[model samples]
Target: MVNTPRLPLLFLDIDGPLIPFGATPQQLPHGYPAYRSRHARPAAEANPLVTRINPAHGPRLMALPCELVWATTWMSDANECVSPWLGLPELPVVDWPETSESSDEDDRSGLHWKTRGLVDRAAGRPFAWVDDEITEADRRWVAAHHSGPALLHRVDARLGLTDGDFDVLGEWLRQRLEAPSSKGVSPASP
Candidate 1:
């Protein structure tokens, strides 16, 4: 019998990455496309923004060689609205910690609130986090604190996850997976 090593994690955000909020006229001259198809887990009263998500992202994300995790403020609701819209299955959701002095300190120091929580969730394993709010502070903090490889990729709120963004992500994740030292939990998706 053999035990394969766990795959790395991909921490995904909702607002900026999947459901873009602040698109300028040039970035999206046609405005965002709406998906008229039915959903498997439709919301009780679905938010209009759910239509903005491109269902194509589901397969693209699933194609990545890592476990997918919801790391957005939407929490479990991401699975309810974003997942079904993208034809994705319910994934593990990261539960944010309650407001605390450490969070306040992190803010004063310019670190993103999600940074620590994500590091904690990664638990010394290789991971990638995609969000609009990421800054150099978050990257520096992760580099200083996290022992394993990490990528703090920032997506444009106006353009959402572009092809270029996917390129960077795919290359980094693939390289990490190919590395002999990479370690994590059971793979969730491809």
Candidate 2:
């Protein structure tokens, strides 16, 4: 029997990646289209913004060769509100560290608050992170700290997840999964 490798983890953020905001009138001339899900509950009815979530994303996300994990501030609420809206099953959520005070140094360093936690969660497994807030600093940090192949794809907040974004993510993950794992080899010596 052939043993199958574990799928890479896909760290998904809500606000920017799923629930897009900050789009100007010029950017979205027709405004963001609202979508209604048949699986939506009465509680979701109260929140009109939930309609902004596209149900089509459910199938698109599921098609990716990775496990989807919620990495949003919405916490468990994402399972309640978003999952149903997207027709996605409840996935694992990242429990963030409770740091009451924001350190100016951390901000100035350009590292996102979620960067370290996501890397730790991957635990040497290949992973892809989707967020509008990803910066070059986060990419550098992940490349330096993570032993496995990682892709930190950034989405435009105004545009949300576009076809181009999905194409890039899918292609990267496909390539990563197809490539042989380089566990102990040093890139410098190769």
Highest lDDT scorer? 1
Give the distance in Å from residue 60's predicted Cα in candidate 1 to where it truly belongs.
0.4
Clashing pairs in 1: none
Q: Summarize candidate 1's per-residue lDDT along 81-163 as a digit string, tens digits.
A: 78887778999999999988898789888999999999999988899898989887888888888888888888888778877
Residue 181 miss distance in model 1 (angstroms): 1.7
- Judge candidate 2 at residue 50 and give its lDDT: 69
Where is the poorest 10-residue window by lDDT in model 2? 181-190
lDDT of 1 at 56: 75
| TM accuracy, model 2 | 0.83
Question: Once model 1 is optimally superposed onto the true structure by TM-score, how far is the C-alpha of residue 51 displaced, in angstroms?
Answer: 1.0
Off by over 4 Å in 2: 22-46, 100-104, 180-190
